[model samples]
Target: MNDIAKHPLAMDGKDPSNLRGDPIDPERYYSRSFMEKEWQQLWTRIWHIAGREQQLAEPGDFIVHDFMKESVIVVKQTDGSLKGFYNVCIHRSQRLVWQDNSQKSFACPYHGWVWGLDGVLEDCPDRGDFPQGDPVGKLKLSKVRVQTWGGMVWYTMDDEGPDLLTYLAPTAELYKNHQFERTVRVNWLRVALNTNWKFWSDNFNESYHTRTVHPQVPPIIDQDHFTSRYEMFPMGHNRIIQMGRPSLRDRLPDGVPHPFDDALRAWDIDPDSYPDFETKAMQGWLDLKAAKKKLWKEKGFLHYEHLDDEELTESPFQVLFPNVAIAPGADSFLVWRWEPHPTDPEKCYFDQWTMAYPIEGQAEFVNRTAVNPLRLVEAELDFREYDNGAGVQEYSDQVVFQDWQLTAGQTAGWRSRGYRDPYFAAQETRVRRFHEVLNDYIAGNPPGR
Candidate 1:
């Protein structure tokens, strides 16, 4: 593994000294009171991804991000800037926008109050009938703090919360090389799962279950803990940088076609040239990095120019505090965001977005997890329920589907009397650290203010 100490802002996430060793209580996952506390303290205070900035390209284009019982609207202004507001009419608290679309102005269905693109009250009926002053040009929609980062529009309900960049900190700085804004969202899917939102937070913070749950991942993106670098930032985000090559310990049966071999051959390297599996896994990985660095520009991989050798060949899976997990690669970016259900602590919505940079000749992008060949375009929203694996039957082969299948069982396990505090491995320190951070938020003290 590379020397993580050489990188700025990189802390040993696997080190127990970085954490408080807080017991991950079971109630945090399934209790109604704890869910309410999280809704008030954590979810509302943290920066939330409303939608991709690409969704709001033109003026007056907006996307409504409904979280729990609250809805927020992120819209593009006439001045070529983005603004966010609570998706409620100022007069009667009626929801102004029901879905994402472009419009000249927001009109309340209940009261006929028209709000302009700038969020000001443009017009209202019966101007002289109100006891107060004229509603037009005086009343404005309530605003939320909005910011853009990594091609996504983010808004926070808390006025005193940290700024987006400050909250993101080294994470935003680490990904400054990749032009995430230029990538197209090839897949936008939401799956309703019967599990707490914390299930995703815990699942993503550790890769210990990858070998058992996502067996296909080890062969493609080395899941060996010793080979990966674990980094936890003070800003409540954690990242695991895994080698993009196959794990030396995980070898497919002899004569089986290897995905790593195909990856090497795609970059003009011969996988068979290596004498053994270990050599092929290790040396082939180095060769792939060299191949990418040497031929990136000629092969139309323009996004790789600013990336370092490690960034070009490694998979950095980042878990932004609480809900968002992003796996950014040289060519493709996979993002997963989990949100709590409106009324059920045992149910949550999960979003998976596959984004890829447009190559000169490549017309489609195949995501590693889903393996779905998607066209290079902004896809429409797709919502599904994990109805015993029937609703999204096509996604049954996905890594997330495997995880979804375990959610119900895990949720039941959490509520079991036999359940006890998690006995975490050193590599799984981030899982406990995530809970400690949640404790911080619940105790009215979150990191970065």
Candidate 2:
């Protein structure tokens, strides 16, 4: 009910007619040939998220994102701009850095050929010995295109593809109220899952599985398809604007303490005053919005000032084409990046970054999907193996943990001879759209070309 005006470029995401009725091909999930094709056609042509812009706050600070078999170094330059290059030394093609850190110049650990933060060769041990006389001051590391949006530093391997904003299209203009650059990431995590990377792409595109998988979420986030607005953009991006209120039908049992009540009381609305559960959910949701609009100034929620009624209390989860998912909510901005494993087609990596806007006096943030409340401070990256859910035991309470647990089953299912095309729900239309757009990319005619 609170959805804002839809952007002109948005397609009806709930309509399956927009898709080409592509089968959710099983071979694409397990075949090496399919994986190589993705690398050549899809992964090479699209933009990728390296890290948050805040990570490179000062000049010389750099972050290295290694995707599949390629690694790229993104550096904050002395001119206050960002630059990216293949993480390879010009001399002998040696890898320069393995991790992120600040450095005035990159010294090739293999042979000590020094290159400046600007990627220009500054020195070499045997300058006179080189037959290519005086390579220093002239030779430069190969550059990758770099850009920033919604607090993320993104780079594309393709030199000729669309710009970041153009690729992001109406999505950039849709959430202009959100000053995502102001948010602070409290959790930075990377986990290796033994499932095709597209599992996440298909999983996040619809909420049809939420009721069965995440039973606790229905009462709080409204899991019903009718109440949500699903939108797919022309550039293959998509969004689902779920009402922030509870599902009126998916009620908790009587005598069970409801989670929705807690939100009502926090917003100073008396949840007990409502005569019935439906009124409390339906009416209290509206009341909660009004209370927030009135109390936000004094309540330290300065981020709410420019947000619309929908943005103030709604959930809009976005999938940025091939791999990135971002939830730019009123209170938090969550990002999930799914990448294929280096060698294993059945393995993939998922990055979950929980970011929260800092309120004036609020020191700790309670993100709904995080395992626990986190202090409003930047957290260093924690990389771990899924190890069949053993390595990620600390994140057991996280909702993504449930999805991680299904990796083994899903991985085996993809390889089964009995595996056939999926019977998709209408709400899962974007899932089909994702694969069709991917098919277009492989055919050398990507959407919005």
Candidate 3:
């Protein structure tokens, strides 16, 4: 691995200078050709997290992923095995599935062609007259490599990319600490953006903007006494660890649960409507030290709290390159999925799966030991209105809007004569590392520093 400390932009004790210039023109990220090349060279050749294994909680349960330019379905067979295949009908190349729930077989909406959960041709209209000698024996949905980790289901466009663990090797140890298989509630969105996918990937890689750009989201928690750390994986994967906010139980009146404590916090309160107090006075401020001390003792945070200053300054912020972010915390975990736009490199879909796992003995979970992942069959959002006058998921929407406004704006500027090479932040080492690894990938050179 190239020593992170010696990289051209890595600076010790001071912010790196190489990264302090104008942000890269978002235009390059919006270019159609640039996106097309990235899709072929990077996305298609790597393992991408498809969905959660729990989604296929039972036999026949399945979810379809519109990956890159291809449609895929990951299904759980009756034998308790997992399988994936192109979501297209073998007959006329039409899509075979639309809904993400379970079915005995997938029947194409265009025609009545049906496929078994195992991707076998279970039924074909007028098959008795065909000379193809029973399409059942000759037709099977084209399959892809499917695997599980931390309870997340992943698939690759390539039949030959490294297995899930191998691709995640650089940060496997840290990821194992996540215990994803034990997680509870998970809700995801399929977001489409009008820019390159990397724009979203790099945005989540750092926290320097939390206090400014995302004041509402960051202010609810303690920002001090934490770390901001990152690890880059070959093949454009990156992980970010942002420190967690201190407990806010004391901020609430006695017997009232902290609003943010609920896994369904977003369902009740929109984060955008909340007040933005500085971290110091945000919650239980007068007695933060005492509150944290008592909360730590009761919650056992003191035990999991790392002694290393770096770990202390940061919480776990991990990004699976190309498109996926697993950001877990003691209170809740956020899983984001970035899907590509079918025709617009300047646009792609984005989804957020906000999950909260019950502590070992929380009464809400009657079967704490049994793997009973909560299912969210409905969302409370008014999608027709971006924020509906609030911004949590919409905050994410706003961020994407900000990105889109700029990327689209920059596309106009890419043609301007005054546009120049971009600069990055010293703290924004993740961005530099991104391009470094990206350049290597583009040149067919080895990944990792």
Candidate 4:
């Protein structure tokens, strides 16, 4: 791994001594009161991703991001800037937009109030009937702080919260090489799961379960704890950088085709030339980096020009505080965001977006987490209920599908009388740290606030 020590904000996420050893209470995962506290203290104060900036390329394009009971609309302005407003009509409390699309102006369906692209009220019915004077030019949609970063549109409900870049901290600086704006979201999917949203935050904080739940990952991305580097930030986010090669601990049975072999051959390295499994896993990884460095431009992988050696062949999975995780690799970027359901504490929505750089001739991109091949274009939203694994049967091969299968059992375990404080592995230190941060937020002491 590169010298993370050079990054002043990076701390050893695997060290238990860095954490407060807070007991992860079971109630926080399933209790309505605890969920309400999170809604008031944590969710409202934090920045949220509305959608990709690519979705609002034109002046009047907009995207609606509904979180729990609140909804926000981020629109592209005529001045080539982005603006966000609470998705509610000024006259009445009706929602302004039902979905994401382009429009010349926002027309409230219940009333004839028309809000301009700039959010000012352009026209309204019964102009002379208002006792408080006409609301046409005087009334405007309530605004939220909007900003764009990494090709994403973000807004925060708390007017006093830290700015988007500051809240993200070193993470924003860490991934500066990635041209996220250049990639297209090939797969945009949201699945309703029968579990609390924190399940994803906990699941993504550690790779200890990958060996048991996602057996195929070790062959493609080394999951062995000793071979990986873990770093935690003071701002509550954490990341794990794993080797992008087959793990010596997880060797396939003799004569079975290795996925790493295909990766090596694609980069013009001969896997058979390594003479041994250990050599192929270690030295072959180094050779693959060299091959990419030498062949990237010729292969039309222009996006790799700014990538360093580590970014070229390693996988760094980042958990952005409470509920976002992203694996930004050389060829593809996989992002996951989990949001709490409006009323039910046990139900949550999980969004998965698979984005890929547009290589010259590649017509399709297959994300590492799933086998489904997606066309290389911006995809429309596809939403479904997990329905105990029946609604999303087409995505059964996905790693997230396997995780979703465990949600019900885990949810039950959390409520069990036998359940207590988690006996966490050293590698799972980030998991407990996440709870500590949540505790801080509920206690009115959120980090970076």
TM-score per candidate, in order?
A: 0.98, 0.98, 0.70, 0.97
lDDT winner between 1 and 4, please give it.
Answer: 4
lDDT of candidate 3 over 1-449, digit per residue (tens): 11223222223311334232334555556667867767667777777776777778799899887766787899999999999998888788998776578888888887787888888888877778778577865689888899887678888877766777777655555544445565655344443444556666667766555556533344344433233344555445555443344323224443544434332232232333435423323332323334443454465443323323223223566666656776655445567767667777656666766665554434342111112343433222222222322333434334434444444444455557687654555556666666655555555552432
Give one digit per residue, the lDDT tens place, for model 1 in 1-449: 66645347767988989887888889888899999999888888999999888888899899999999999999999899998999999798999988999999999999899999889999989999989788899888999999999998999999998899999887777888899988988888998988999999999999999999998889999988988999888877999999999987899999999999989998999888999889999899989989999999899999998998888888899999989999989898889999999999999999999999999998888876664888888888899887988988988888988888889899999998998899989999999888888899999999986
For model 1, how many clashes?
A: 0
Q: For candidate 4, what is the total of clashing residue pairs?
A: 0
The C-alpha RMSD in Å for every predicted model, in order, reads: 1.2, 1.2, 8.6, 1.3
Ranking, lDDT, top scorer first: 4, 2, 1, 3
Higher-TM-score candidate of 3 and 4: 4
Model 2, 1-449: lDDT tens digits are 44467778888899999888977779999999999999999999999999989989899999999999999999999999999999999779999999999999999988889999999999988788877688899899999999999999999999999999998888789989988998988998999888999999988888898898888788888878988988999899989999888898798889999998999998899889999999988898899899999998899898888998888878888898899898998899999999999898999999999999999888899976786889999988889999988998988877899888877888899889998999988999999999998999988899767
> In terms of lDDT, which candidate is strongest?
4
TM-score of 2: 0.98
Q: Report the lDDT of model 3 for residue 344.
A: 79
Better of 2 and 4 by lDDT: 4
lDDT of each: 0.89, 0.90, 0.57, 0.91
lDDT of 4 by residue, 345-448 (tens): 99999999998899999898877665478889889889999999999998888798989999999999999999988999999999998899889999999998
Off by over 4 Å in 1: 4-6
Clashing pairs in 1: none
Tell me how far candidate 4 lies from the true structure as C-alpha RMSD in angstroms: 1.3
> In lDDT terms, how accurate is model 3?
0.57
